[model samples]
Target: MSATPSSKLPPFDPRDPLGLDDLLTDEDRAVRDTVRQWTADRVLPHIAQWYEDGELPGIRELARELGALGALGMSLTGYGCAGASAVQYGLACLELEAADSGIRSLVSVQGSLAMYAIRRFGSEEQKQQWLPRMAAGEVIGCFGLTEPDHGSDPAGMRTYAKRDGGGDWVLNGRKMWITNGSVAGVAVVWAQTDDGIRGFVVPTDTPGFTAPEITHKWSLRASVTSELVLDDVRLPAAAVLPEAKGLGGPLGCLSHARYGIVWGSMGAARTCFETALDYARTREQFGRPIGGFQLTQAKLADMAVELHKGILLAHHLGLRMDAGRLRPEQVSFGKLNNVREAIEICRTARTILGANGISLEYPVMRHATNLESVLTYEGTVEMHQLVLGKALTGGLDAFR
Candidate 1:
């Protein structure tokens, strides 16, 4: 059967070649646009300066603003959280990272790691006392799982929490590469105990708790990275998260954070891709726009394909998450693939922009450097590969 062509179909938009926007509902589009506007108004204009200064000045003020926007814990229910769907949270991550990966890291560490730990494992009193303030950004929180000596193998962590004669829990150890550490009012410190591994909700002002800022970092300079030192920090029995036990507790929180990275990395790629595409169209060589050349066109075409494909993959994961069917191995798959591809896109974009790409005046170099950190944090490439490998090989453990 032959069908007549309809003129009602909309013309293809270069920005959305695959018409992926059609997949979003009106509410979803509204959420995405709102975050996009917020980033344009607040983040994009000042990010270069922030990156150059290696400081996120007025970070407390920004936290309050983000809290007002319900971006602190957008997917968590109650406790003043937005209670949004996982897809919406993923969209917010995308928009935030489009401005800077540091910004997205702040949100991920806050909502996915710290808040999720308390919400999922803490006692009711703990949740009631902390979640509201954390969600409102009145108090910022940091997750302490990764140690100076341990990155992938967290079971070897030297940090220990022990019960004293008075039933007080005493902690001692150091955590490295902790985001939101110095500024966080609270720290969720995971430590080895007599029973096993347990999590402690320690106030930053505790007598022996100090978060010293890590300095002179070339990557993620606009973000707060610190080392948490807990020397005999004492807490009441109520401070321990009762529900979580063993290494699974912290690993669960990490899986949630990695899910956000799956989307956030693509956002960085999108910005770089757009920068390259626009530059290719306007920059001229041999008495014509460079985009007129076959080589430039090929780069743009390939970048576009990968960039959108990553977004599609993130969306698929977001859906699975919302449906409560997402597995840790699957999350590892998304994180491994999207972050690797996103970095490649950024490097390719740098080539398209020539020397201008290296300048802070352009975002390409900053994003590229930032993605370098993103590639290793959460879970390194090797870690995720082992995860997928074990899954495929029917539980063949390779980390020995």
Candidate 2:
């Protein structure tokens, strides 16, 4: 059988997907269609309220629904995941983020950061212990690597894990800016061992584990960010992720999360672009719709062009990743370029909308605001610049 119209391949528009490509198999089409409709109906109706409330009220339920749709770690081949291709995973991120970045962050952190770590490094037993529950969203998970003092430089972590009197590991340190921290039942925490940085799975109920909510976030307001305190927190030796050692482990997980950002940010741009297109066609200026004006059309054109480039870039990267040939630097390229361009697109779209852009009634300003966080997190633009710089030059001047 042929692919669906949504894949945007040959017989589909090269410049845009436009739901005309037979690229995605019928199953993928169905998945994309399902998420698109769900986001439009379930999320759009209540998104403004959630945004205003500064919290996702029905997130557990929402997460469970996503799990049912095979969104959690959707690209991973097994472990109750969707077992979708990388493109499908990108599509899922796109749909979620089109609703809101915070919504997408919830899924991305859970799937790419938390679940990918376990799936990549967890033992079969550990996988069996937690994957299914997390996949179902019955239990939530978070990744903790960025400490209060160690933001960009995670390797300088002070969170320490030492072998205890009985062979268990006792952890002590603070993890800040953690997503899903307050609600996570299980957290994949990184800490310094004698062997360098290692990750551990700590149950939130662990005696000394406490995560207090970090409030007043002007960005990603609908998502939860918090501080995780490990005061003599202890875990079994089995809690250790034996498959990984040193910074490579968490960095690997970050590469996964960064891939999602590449698509997710573009999703935000798509929303802004679409909103601006509609506004331009309607809001009267001078004697006709502002879209008639050269300046307005030019702004819309730029948004469209940049959005298309971002989409194609992400799709190409997804193709490479599916083939197991993608690199960290490539991810850095996508994350950095797409977010930077998408943010500009949203800002441009907002400017065309004039005052209405800042209103919650329109999507551009919110996407623009959320893009600020997206630009900084998952390795900042500068970090990715250095990553690419190192790729091009034999010299390593990132930190030095």
Candidate 3:
């Protein structure tokens, strides 16, 4: 199925009847409308089958289209990027995730994690090598940070890279829970250097570099996740990202990824909320519309309230980021609050369907399950708390 001929993409119709425009700037609205149109055309019509098949075949091509629209790395400046405002990026995220969190995961990892990592840390040569292909979706990239034993505490990561003679390096370690690992043509891997932790751009074909797809996962099934095993992989000095140093380097990338999650999760919540609302309005209870009752209204009301607040929080944080005053802890704050609220919204929306919620005919259950992964990854719930606690008390005690 193709998108309706309508050039606009607000729910069911365009023209701002819902007044969501009040939440967006003109630029943000334009970006959102474009992505929403793309998703409706490319994703929604085919998603149920893809969801059933457990894979989205068009993801890579869809990513390239997003890149052309400047949706990929839109917030980043220069190097063939959109360089748009962070608020606009947030709106793009919302529209993409409104389609599915798994697809949104692809965008966030490519744009925020992979592209941002290279742009922020890599040497000029490395950026020139990867950023252009990535922005064009010609080469997919994944961030390899969490290890088998270091999901919650990456500093404890055992992956190590040692400098050999002639500016060459040998890397050995396993990276766990890597998104896009299976399909990525490039991987941004962090390893412990003799001096400290450092990041590397390891091509997937590097000898001894292998990523085995993780299968039968209940969460984020439509997205690819894999374990990257680096068995004495060799790299040139150019592999090292020059500007990023210390723990802040990888953590900085996580902060960028989390900001995208803040917006993306709201899209997931909105989908489930809307599904539940429509169900309530049509699914008869005692020969009366469930939506007419106070109980169903209460659930819809809560979902709306939470989704609205999450979007506002993400939108405000986007402004701060554009101002260059946003702190890592602030990113953590949005990641923590919005994801939690979105998960709750999904759960409540799922309950509105009674038994039908668990069925694939509805998206609430899938969104809820995927939200579980969203909450756990990208500096888990407790880790964000530690970050926020440190911000206030100057103490980073909890996740260390």
lDDT of 3 by residue, 145-220 (tens): 9988888878899999998887899999999888899889999999998899999999999999999988788888
Highest-TM-score candidate: 1
lDDT of 3 at 374: 93
lDDT of 2 by residue, 1-400 (tens): 9766765645543235453244567876787788888899879898877777888888789889888888888888677877888888988898889999998999999999999999999899888888888888887899999988988999899999999779999999999989999999999999999878899988899999999988887788889888999999989999999898999999999999999999899899989988888888899978899999998888877778888878888888988999999999999999989999999999898888899899998887778888899999889889899999998898667665
TM-score of each: 0.98, 0.94, 0.93
List the candidates ranked by lDDT, beginning with the highest.
Answer: 1, 2, 3
| RMSD of candidate 2 to true structure, Å | 3.9
Which 10-residue window in model 3 sums to the lowest lDDT? Answer: 9-18
By TM-score: ranked, best first: 1, 2, 3
Cα lDDT for residue 266, model 1? 93
> Which is better, 1 or 2, measured by TM-score?
1
- Model 3 TM-score relative to the real fold: 0.93
| Candidate 2, pairs of clashing residues | 5-21, 8-21
Q: Give candidate 1 misplaced runs (Cα > 4 Å).
A: 1-8
